[model samples]
Target chain A: MKLNSIHSITSSELNAFFEENRQRTLCYLESRFPVLQEDDIEDIFQDSSITLFLKIQNNELLDLTSSLYTFFLSICINIARNKVNRSHPTYLLSDNITDSDFEPIRNDKLEELENLVGYEIAEEQTDQEYLNWIEQQVREGVRQMKPPCNQILWSFYWDGLSHRTIADMFGMKSEDVSKTQANRCKHKFSDFIKKVIASYER
Target chain B: MKDNSIYNEQIDRFLKGQMSTEEEQQFKTEIGQNPELKQQVREHLYLIRGIKQVKSQEEQKIILQEQHEQKVTPLRRNWIKITSIAASITFIMVLSGIEGSRLYYRHEIRQYAYNASVGVMSDFAASSRGTIDEETKVHLTDLFTNAQEGKDLAETIDELSRLYVLTKDEFVDIEDDCAYQIGWFLAVSYINDGDYEKALEIINNIESEYPDNEDIKSIQKQLVEFLK
Candidate 1:
């Protein structure tokens, strides 16, 4: 499949891409990066998969010229690189390292990595374990949130679709209507998260 | 809760890096000065990241099963044949009021092979007494004690899984070794519950990581043979 075709990517096709490349990617990672253990390799693979999905959704791959596997592996490599640089995230998060945890990469290494991955890597933020935990609630909220709101939030935030595109997709009356709906869904999701977090703390 | 919907668009732009540098700088100043805005920014990040994780997991579910099948259960074509045996494995050591010692089975396949797996788990529990971490040691004792007494099989499996994942994330090789040891007990726990497929999964994975262990190989052979 052409890399350019990601503009119209659908769910099934993306799953097929995953099933097809899943083994080969593991084999590739195991051979190329001996430092990563099995679980770490799987974690990196998942992160890279999400990164690829987000890039495609945002239309950020317009200039890419590599084949699908090459593009995907480039991501895995960069993530593995980051994995090597970090340690057990549980310890990091347990200390509540809020501001100091988002350690910026050195300029020289950052440039080298950015060039290799063909895109900018986010500055290392706080521990991924915390992000992973927060994401768990977000997922539950999305599934249990009111209908149309959940669907609308997914299409808007996740798919990166514009109001016009979402309106066309959802068959809403107009872009303005879709925008209003998307805004409401975002608030509902945010509120959903707030309530859930408060409950967990209690 | 106050209406924070007005800041949604601006937060989205800031989190998504859609803001210009100057806009981002001004927004960062505001966020630094306001605790509520900082909290909102985190929640929005959670929503965006969480939804994307959910979608990735949808794809992940299929691939994980396929990965499991590829590593272990290649004999899935004969799955129906095995299920028809009405297999209900019973560990005699499970003295938790779950039918004292009468090996419960509908078809009565060779009982000794399954017992051989139970023996392996008992030996692992014995040897693991003092050589592991105190934190893991506590769970390890409960895992085997519950297995021996046949207490709450579901909870045992869940706790073992959690323990395995937590130890693995700590990035210590000793914990990895401990986790592999724990896999044997978990596999037996599944076999005890008559969950042969899940048992085969852990055994096969352990075999892949440690191919030379004759005991693990023997357990795998016995499982496949009994299923046949």
Candidate 2:
């Protein structure tokens, strides 16, 4: 039987595939990142499998160019790398690591990072101290933004709500109005950061 | 201001990956030519990343607190424990049921083969009198006697298969009763040797070819049920 597509796989077949490839994925991670604990490897494996399964279920992974094992390995590698980045940021910085250096094979992660962060920051290499400083500045800017602007920006970006949803929440004239307001708020916030950076430089 | 709005819209589309291949290439070319626009894109990206990081930390703290609360609650803990036990029990029960059905079907097939063999032997004895050649008759009688006497059943089955093929080739004018007796003997030998697949195949053939034969029909029905 030629099982080329994910749709053709039965539940039992899927479970068997996961069980068989799980050990191989763990072994791959152990080889690549020996410092990762057994528990961390297991967590990465679980998270990768769940993410892959959900993507397949939702029809997000429509065209698979590689074998299932290759796809699985890529997901595990990406996840393990991200966990390492989060837990050992200083170590990563010492190695002169950057976000762009760890380009994921899966396009979903790339798209997600791009949407959450901007392309430049997503690609830039920086230390944890710089990241913390920028985070502080962003929080301050958000806090100082006038009444509804902060709330609108929070809803649109942080909460991942749509302009239409924000418009409905805040009783705006339309989705276009919500979008315009969001852009204005983003500019205002950006100006706050510029002022802070200018003062800090002086 | 118009250029900034257009640039922001373009940046948004680029970040979201909503652009076509051609548009993306064009935007990339534009970014390469313009350094100030590139800087603006970088700054915007950093701001977005910082905000996301702060929000993510807050969400993580909320998640950790919720998990801690769930662990502290005795009622929730008891419910989770009970559910896990119930699920384990149900899984074991399902596994046992599948194994039980497999054993039951095997027993049914063996019993049916034994009864069918006895009936075929009697029919052979009654029908073989003066019609079959003396030498062929002796050979078949010896084979059946050895099978009944609890001798090597695998050897008996192999001899039965050869005898069946010989009968079909050499005895064109043989009685219908004798021909069917040979086929039945071959099938029952297969069953006794635990070759149910071959036994079922012969039984199905007999049933289809002799649709009016009640005995073959009954055997076919039993084999089908055992298989199911």
Candidate 3:
């Protein structure tokens, strides 16, 4: 459906759509970020939903596309990016980037549609054993990290906390919190890749 | 040039956008000069990208499922199928526990499998063994032991291990209880093989939820004595 047409759906109807997509979105957000918490995820989506709903009401949405999910994902991503930027995240190296001229490419490598279809196919390929193994590894990796680091990182990444708020939540200097987060999580990212490759090799 | 450790840390921070403006400039300049650093940065990006790809795929699947559900003809009997599946699983679990002899056999077989592979079976076999009920460890140890025997422990352990070795070099698939069980077995085997300190260390790290478990308590006691 077109953006204008979809935008006409009532707030209650929009909420129902959000609820329907919640589980799938949660799984996506968790894997993508891996450090966000449930509450944070709920909050981010709640805010996103409200923002989207208002946008539609005000005719701010330029286009809604074919489905509610597409529109919702766009809204969520925009909100997330805004939140990340506002946090003034302290990446150990963020301070080093005095060259404001350098901008990283922020292209989308994964699509919401492709993911859903792929998941249908992947569901058969991923047996319980594999899922169990990956989940266990993730849990163990999280366990090894310092409690605050693990908690805050998961809260932001998996659960969708803005970096600024995460800083406030942890009560650390935002920059230091971000640095600790990035440093602690770097190892997990490497380790996760190694494990996935190892599993595929096996 | 940055020290290897510093360079790695810098690379990590740069990739995560944690670097300061000055440091980020320096990092970028270093990358400009060094092909190796550039490659490391690329690899890091790829890892993050790959994870995002997986996440996106999962999200898409959920959306697809919802759409599919909407288009598909509604089946009034889905609950029946779900209930049947649930019943079957419950039945299998119950059946597994039935007949004292069968339960004993399952427990004994697991212990035997552990003994065969790891060279030491903890008090899982001994009647007088302490009350530490290490359930999680039991499951993992059983799977590893069974896998070692290959073909469900109805076959030779070495032969099974060899046939499966090509699939995954890793000796164990520690899913849920399986990991805890096998980890414990491996730790104990290390101890039995005269690596007391390593055994103590390994056991200490391989945690069980039930600290008060009889088997765990006994192991802790054993570890304390060994340390002494």
User: What value does the interface RMSD of model 1 take?
Assistant: 18.2
Worst 10 residues of 1 chain A by lDDT: A113-122
Fnat per candidate: 0.16, 0.13, 0.01
Per-residue error (Å), model 1, residue B126? 31
User: Residues A62-149, candidate 1, lDDT per residue (tens digit)?
Assistant: 3333334456766887787667667544322222212221221122322221222211011232232232234345666766767577
Which residue segments of model 2 deviate by more than 4 Å?
A1-132, A143-146, B72-228
**lDDT score, candidate 3, position B187:** 48
Predict model 2's lDDT versus the native.
0.54
**Candidate 3 ranges beyond 4 A from true positions:** A1-105, A108-162, A169-173, A191-202, B1-29, B32-36, B69-228
Candidate 2 lDDT over B25-118, as tens digits, reads: 7877776667656656766665554454333333322222222333433222222222221122111111123533443344334434433344
lDDT tens per residue, model 1, B97-214: 2221112211022232222333333334444556766786676767865543334668988977676566557565554445765776677667656676777888898899888765
User: Taking the tens digit of each residue's C-alpha lDDT, what string does model 2 give over A54-157?
Assistant: 55444333233333444666687778777888887655423332222121123342233333333323234233223334444665565456657865665555
How does model 1 score on DockQ?
0.08
- Sorted on DockQ, highest at the top, how do the candidates line up? 1, 2, 3
Ranked by lDDT, top first: 2, 1, 3
Q: Considering just chain B, what TM-score does every model have? A: 0.43, 0.49, 0.27
TM-score of chain B of 2: 0.49
* lDDT (Cα, tens digit) per residue for candidate 3, span B42-132: 4344333333323322332333233223333221122112222112111111123233323222222222222223212221222112433
